[model samples]
Target: MRRFHIALAVADLQDSIADYSRRLGVEPTAVVPRKYALFRTDQLNFSINQMPERAGQLRHLGFEDDAASGFSSTHDVNGIEWELFSPADQDAKIPEVYGKEVIRAG
Candidate 1:
């Protein structure tokens, strides 16, 4: 399966998580306190980061693909970053990327 992934920067992590949970109709899969959150659904792999100055901005886009070889990222002609990774690949990178331990939410 391949799920479209979206990442955004938000002003508040907790607030965004609550709102997005309602919007997505499911709680986040993992969270890093006031830093980050990940929400995975059948068709969407969504996440948000607490970056006040970059609030409401798209951080990047990606795909959560089961058949993906490994985590990889590149930029498009417009300079928008895109990633291709499996769930396990993402799980392994979470701590390294966020520099904090994550707590599974649901």
Candidate 2:
């Protein structure tokens, strides 16, 4: 399973929520006033952040991987920050992927 993910900074959270809700034809999956919103459609998942410090900027860009091979980056790049929901198994080196026993380095 795969989904397209995108995130953008919004000047007005309420207005953006309404606009996206209407455009996407659905309400946000989660909404925190003056903070952020998550909109999910059939093929796209996007988040809108109410960024007063950096309005009209990209908040992040990336997709959530169910397999979570631990390749996703979770840091800032050129002032843009990205996030991913990693499985708890992420820290564990998946043996199936490595073809051998993997140990975590201290």
Candidate 3:
């Protein structure tokens, strides 16, 4: 089954990890390059990463499901719309910032 994920840019990995750990009651599953980390849960994958140089402000939000059938439903919601990476196909170039498998919807 597919799982939803959220990636956030943080300035301090350790502080963020500690705060999130105390708040969420879980530690990260992976830590890469001292600037990236991931926390997994039964229904969500939360990640933190360093922002790229010269990148403008960015915020991405989307959903994941075993099948690519909920985009339209979620899109119709009042404050949501089509994100750049939703309904990602097998051949889609998953962004480096994500650092996770983009499971194809069955």
Candidate 4:
């Protein structure tokens, strides 16, 4: 299966991590110094990275699915549309897989 992680750039690593932990109700699995932090869920892997100018900005989005499965759909954020997928073809919609309320910025 193809698996990937989405990394976001933030200004305050600790603050962001804490906020996300509370919001997502899960602590990060790994924390790297001034570099990145990793949070792995059952279906998705969320990461935070420290960047100078683009802090608190959306870095990139990713998906994890079997190579054989076709791309399901895409999410439009700002003016860009991000392709989405699932670990299995029979799985629910993309928004259901990754919380629908989660905002994706451009």
Q: Pick the candidate with the highest lDDT.
A: 1
Error of 1 at 78 (Å): 1.1
Off by over 4 Å in 1: none
Residue 79 lDDT (model 3):
59
Give TM-scores for every candidate, taking all chains together and pairing residue i with residue i.
0.96, 0.64, 0.51, 0.54
Worst 10 residues of 2 by lDDT: 86-95
Candidate 2 Cα misplacement greater than 4 A, ranges? 69-71, 74-106
Scored against the true structure, residue 27 in model 2 reaches a CA lDDT of 84
The superposed Cα distance between candidate 3 and the true structure at residue 81, in angstroms, equals 9.6
**What is the C-alpha lDDT profile of model 2 across 1-106, one tens digit per residue?**
4456788888898999899889989887656556767776777768787887787877677665565556465666575556554324322323443334333322
Tens-digit lDDT string for candidate 3 (1-106): 5556566777676777788777767777666655666665667656666665522222344545546632333353565443322334312333344445433222
Best of the two (2, 3) by TM-score: 2
Candidate 3: Cα lDDT at 95: 35
Candidates, ranked, TM-score: 1, 2, 4, 3
How far does residue 4 in candidate 3 sit from its true spot (Å)? Answer: 1.9
Candidate number of the best TM-score = 1
Q: TM-score for model 2?
A: 0.64
Task: Look at candidate 4 and give me any clashing residue pairs.
Answer: none
